[model samples]
Target: MDIKQRILASSCATRWFLFGLVLIGILSLISSEWLVPSIASADEQSGRYLSIWARLATTTGLVVFEVAMTTFLLAVAYLLLTPRDDRSGDVSVIEGSDVGRSLHEHLRTTESYWFKGRSARWVRDVVFPILSNRASTDQIRINLFMALPDPSNVKLMKEYADYRESIAYKGSKDTWTQEIVTTHILAAIVSAYHNASKSNFLNVCIGLSDWFPAYRVDITDGSAVMTVEDKNAPAMRYTRTSSFYSTFRADVEHTIEMGTKLPKPVSSFRNRELDATFVNEILAHAGLSGTLNGAVNEESILKKINNSGQLYG
Candidate 1:
């Protein structure tokens, strides 16, 4: 049956049941001598086991009253304490660490997940374990829509970096310069993809855009998790059945479409043939120089994945 029909069937006479219980409890509490005419109470209920039981209850008086009152109280308490089940398309406003948790849950699922953000550190961290999974190998496809680390946009990236650094992470007093942020953004992307290449079953897609998003969006086929820059602020959660989901999906699509794909380096990495030379070629495809910082800072992040199997931190 549907939700309404099921509700009706389950709660057929709950109101009446509550009403009767309350009335019985009140009547029993009164202990009126005239209302239950003492000895005649035995004669009033007779002839069957149930009637005999009723007579016994009548004789017992306050005991039966206590049971009725307790039953009512317990039912009310149960109703107050029970949590409702999660329904499809429900929206939950969550905050802080919950935002990271929400993204983690979405990406962990077998279904497709799309990510668009500045530095996808949370996404990268969650994706590593999934890439190592042997059970669902080659079954999952993850899309990372990242901002291109084009050297020409370094000036604009500095502005973005300043804005991002202004918001403290976990109450940290540390600071990041524009080069640090730029290298980090570049490192996070390259490290995640290079590591994923080791997985035979996982497919990682990279799409680079010149523009940076104001917020982060991690969405699956059914649910979308979005968070703003303020770590203390609440994040938004929505399902495919919502307008937010539809609009958000469309927005995700448009943003990704605007991106230029970087497939060669990822392909070469998967084939165990990726190097700084090819890395430069990949960057050049996106209008970036491989010598961005003379292959020391951001370019070196790929070596960690190659040598130690550690993600860019």
Candidate 2:
């Protein structure tokens, strides 16, 4: 047998043996007391044999009960600690081709389920159109060094931005930017759900940066802020600040309000991660990586990009 099988077998054997030992101890204790007293009226030799038999029976009963209780406790512990795997290892052949497809499909499905559809559609139709436009295409390539605990989050965010850009510049130009903004909102929602603690606040900030044309999102211990400078509209230049608690609370409240405003048939809460995936994918296609990291104290992302030289000449 394989190692896993061997291990399983050994564990089972050990458990049974322990149960047997417990039963033996219980039997010995009973035989020396209760069994011996019950058979005192019988001949000495007869009484001794009877008492021994009684003890053996009692021990067997005790062992069975102890083994059952131990098994039950072990099963409960296993269920609590084990991470569930939903994927089935079933394969089907269609036209002699393997059924397995690209990971993008998996991402798409996950996003679809997580977002509940609206967020996903917004990214595709709105976000991508804005980011991939040639007129603003250069703005999408700005680099903001991120210090995220999980690089996968950054990589995923980047891939989604690129994907959106590709779709936006399919043929014509005039890409849209609002889509990127919407994506940032979605990514924030997703990050908040996955890592609710303060330590992960940076990830949320970085993920939101993709939407801004110029600025980056920064998260410190106290609050989240945006910083930027606007050359075209100097009047709009200023640092914007919002507490992480306030921002998340506002987002949740806004979502709840939006849900309430929707028709009864569409008023269901969606998984934040799924919504984030849709937003990320859509924004990605548009060449927008809305605020995945940096300072959020700027008046506008465009202004920050211009001030920090995040945008190319």
Candidate 3:
């Protein structure tokens, strides 16, 4: 039935029930007066007092009955008027936009990038350690985002321990390690695009070397050398150096050539064929193809030296 019809029916039923109960109670009280034997009295005063007491008792019972009926009727009315059943089916998909808008507004009101108050402690102690130990292969990758102010731009640093533990000892290599390293390298390349001038480039190089002391860095006008060292013994190093890049043409060539030597572990999300497709996708994103022309491609590489002399495994 419709809401209005249901409410009307319930109200009518409740009124009738209350009327019947009141009528029965009144009849019982009247009957009690007639059925009870009169008490012997020494005077008319006692008789009068007894009649008054009976009247008062009957009034009290009627008052109680009225209060109970009123309360019941109010409760029934409330239930009948209240909504029932889920409205989920009636809601449109577009209705979710309002919820999203509200959440966005709330975030905007409370948003702050700088840690303050209690959050400062977490940022200092917790986040720094977690960032330092992110890689399972005893490597920590740090990315310098493009938006940051230079003297430091387009910088990437990796600090790793020079040891390989067997998988049997629960100290094995993880499959995701290479992928994580690649991501950090990719982030550094992306950051380089933001620099408006080459003056900041040298500063960026210097900042990276300082940030990751484990990696020995030697930067010249057109070439750079980076060496990843053993954590236990800093004296030991695995070095990789790039050839001269006089122009952007030379730089692009060196970046791609260096990228080729990087290890590609089995991707969790892609099969071999899919992985090939994904690599092509990244190349396309970087606006790089297999062939590099001297003019259009700003960078060119003269040579690359990978010093594996100290590499144990």
Candidate 4:
């Protein structure tokens, strides 16, 4: 927004105007508190004209101080009485830079959240913060609907994962294949299970399905936000009252059908570290079972997530 547009924004303009009123009041109070008193206390030994002028200045300053303070109070009252902007059914065209903030704002207020998307290294960026936020709150459930890497769609899934890996900053990712993609999803499950173990509030659930959503959709009780995989398009926010929200909500219901929930991987784990034994359990849960199978080593996946970073969104 340009300076003129910013100055004309209802909230911005009102806030700035309130600020101006407070500043004026503060200046006037300073005059009355110190400057005016000094002048009003001027010595009577001085010329009569000087003393009278001092009294006049001090009196005017006092009146100005009172008026300024009264105006400031009235401005506050006006703000208090004003109605807030009505945004029911309004859809927000969220800029790319604002996606995470928009998501966080909605997530914080969500009673339940539904995230449907394919695997991408950036998935951590989307999920971990909510886990952190939930750590301090009453329990909130985050249901992750991941694209299942089954035989029917494994090739397509691999291509999708490769494309996702391509976009991350250089030296931070690998040319992904079926095993790597599976391992990455495994990492997310591990992360979720580990965090869930640490707190009662971490009600994170992971489900996998053959359905690969075209993009990412975050559905909350009150709103639904969608973003494209490449992020070339802007994010969109749909309020619960909007028709679009119903459509997306229905879509989420449909997408979740036949989904497989996490196998809970060994029933218990005490830490976040990845080891050969832990990796075997993760694969066995995914039905790969016994040894590394085709999956990359736990060390490689660990380095990819820690040093290179990002895993899914």
Candidate 5:
């Protein structure tokens, strides 16, 4: 094995060794003090000292044994009852990036990638990387349904700005206003389209929807990862096998079924018309009608994004 593997193996071995020591020490104390004992008469002081020592040792050993046994049982229950990383749904509900790892391990290029979420943060961090690495086939389709920005109502916008400043953000609330967050998401989509290999076919459409629960569907010919939403914590991501890819794919199709034409792959010169149209739509969704009307270009779009979604136009 490699050095990293060897180190990991060694570390696991050390943990087992320590646990074994705890068990062995407790058993040895029980055997010496209770199972096999010597009775010898002595003075009262010496007898009292012996009695106290025996009780202390017995108590300590029993506590150690009980604690160790309980810990082992709890760990076993967690392993058996808790979800495995490899599968989801009726199978199991594994937590954290195990869902991502398991999907990557078995992911095939023919698999379709679908994501519906409030922000595309998980898409940018997890789904994009997985597809970029594993899927090599032509005609890859990514279906995304991201929450759209609130339509421009000055009162609502001000309220949202206050809520964002008060509730949802960490660090300086000034760092990312609601509109800035939407602009960043749009920028990510634009980047994805621009950077995708032109030789390989890629059809990705991001539709704007409101209050869609976040989930990702990555389906191979054999296996799939259908992320389960934790409603109490929408940010938490977990997945089960995709028994629902078809339904999800249909849902995504139905949203785009509004006759939204897929934008052509962006480039420095080619596909400017399609890019412009797509960017305009994205800007309008972010409540930036002023920037859209002022002849939205790359510079103006980026400027609004950098200036916290305030269109100076």
Candidate 6:
């Protein structure tokens, strides 16, 4: 039967069972007074049986009462302890720049970046610059989670870019379309991840999946970066940031927990596929010619950064 029917059936069964027990209990108590006198007059063996039956009935009745009372107590406790629905989403807002600053200040930090946006250009624009100017003592452990570049996601992003261009710059001669920009940012992030893997200063993990949410969270050692995507805006804003141990932090943790539980990409580190075909496609699409060939020389990358001008520190 369906859920409602099953629920009704179970309720009916429970009610009847409880009613029967209550009736039996009342009868046993009433009968005990008269039965007790008869038990003393009956043969010893019959008297023993009657005594045992009476005790069993009394014990069963007491057990049912206790179970009912305990359930009531638990229901009351749950009502008292649970948070109100109105305040469930009550996370404190933190500026995106402030979050960027926390990453800049920490010498050693742990972080996770989760996103389902086109290219995640913000990382290259905001995150990379902070890391570039870090002190010699600075180190970062990062877990980068991105939505798998499936056909549907690509189509969605392209449509979004078209809408953005129509409203933001209809007549501009900009070479960077939404698709190209998104690929570029993905390439930049991946390139940085590769370089970090070669260094003691940064440790990185990557998870690719098609089931990511359209939000971004960067959780570091002492602070968290959180934002919800606004479809109407040109970009998503970092809406909340808090201590790593705050209630907001707990919500971020839950988000991470859900993300990790999804199926990992087939060409993942877990599967020992270091140079996955998917990774190469992203780099190639971004026009990073030699990144797929493991030709990323440390000195060359440093020089490129140096030529890029003012850092964000």
Candidate 1 residue lDDT tens string, 1-313: 4544443555534554466667766666565554456546555476324367776777687566667776776665444333232333367888665665666665555455567777665555555456446324655544444434333466767777788777766655446666655655665566555555666555556666677778887777668878876666788898767677777767766765677665534455564445666555455654455437853353465553344322111
Rank candidates by TM-score, best first. Answer: 1, 4, 5, 6, 2, 3
Estimate candidate 5's RMSD in Å.
13.6
Better of 3 and 6 by lDDT: 6
Q: Whose lDDT is higher: candidate 1's or candidate 2's? A: 1
lDDT of 2 by residue, 1-313 (tens): 4434543656664565556557656665665566555555464656444466776776676667656766765554343333222112111112211111211122221211111111122222322223223113332231111211111244544554554455443233323233343344444333332222212111111222212222322222222222222112111111113223245334433433433221111112222333334444433432334444443222232232222221111
Residue runs of model 6 more than 4 Å from their true location after superposition: 1-90, 95-117, 129-153, 163-178, 211-214, 228-313
Best by TM-score: 1
lDDT of 3 at 186: 35
Candidate 6 on 1-313: residue-level lDDT in tens? 4434543556554454455557656655655565554555564656454467776776566567656755665454333333333134323444534444543444244354443433444554555445433422455445544433322245544655565455453334444454443444455444444444343444333333334334454544544444443322231222233223355445544544543322322223222222445355434533443432222333333333333422112
| lDDT (Cα, tens digit) per residue for candidate 4, span 101-197 | 6676766666566667664344454555565466546555544443333322456557767676666544443465666666665555545555555
Candidate 2: worst-modelled 10 consecutive residues by lDDT: 109-118
Model 5 spans > 4 angstroms off: 1-91, 97-99, 102-110, 129-176, 210-243, 258-262, 266-313
lDDT for model 6, please. 0.43
Show the colliding residue pairs in model 4.
Answer: 120-312, 121-311, 121-312, 122-312, 123-312, 123-313
Query: TM-score of every model?
Result: 0.59, 0.21, 0.20, 0.56, 0.42, 0.38
* Between candidates 1 and 6, the TM-score winner: 1
Question: What local distance difference test score does each model get?
Answer: 0.59, 0.32, 0.29, 0.59, 0.45, 0.43
* Clash statistics: count for each candidate: 1, 52, 11, 6, 1, 1
Q: Give the lDDT of residue 4 in candidate 3.
A: 59
- TM-score of candidate 3 to 2 decimals: 0.20
Candidate 6 residue-pair clash tally: 1
lDDT of 6 at 164: 46
> Between prediction 1 and prediction 2, which has the larger TM-score?
1
Over the stretch 1-313, how does candidate 5's per-residue lDDT look in tens digits? 4434543556564465456657766766765576434322233436543567776776577667767765775464334433344223433444544554555554444445554433344455445545544434434553333232222333443444455455442333244354544444455454445334332444455554433333544444434445543322222223333434455556655654542333444444233333556566545443445523223355544554334321111
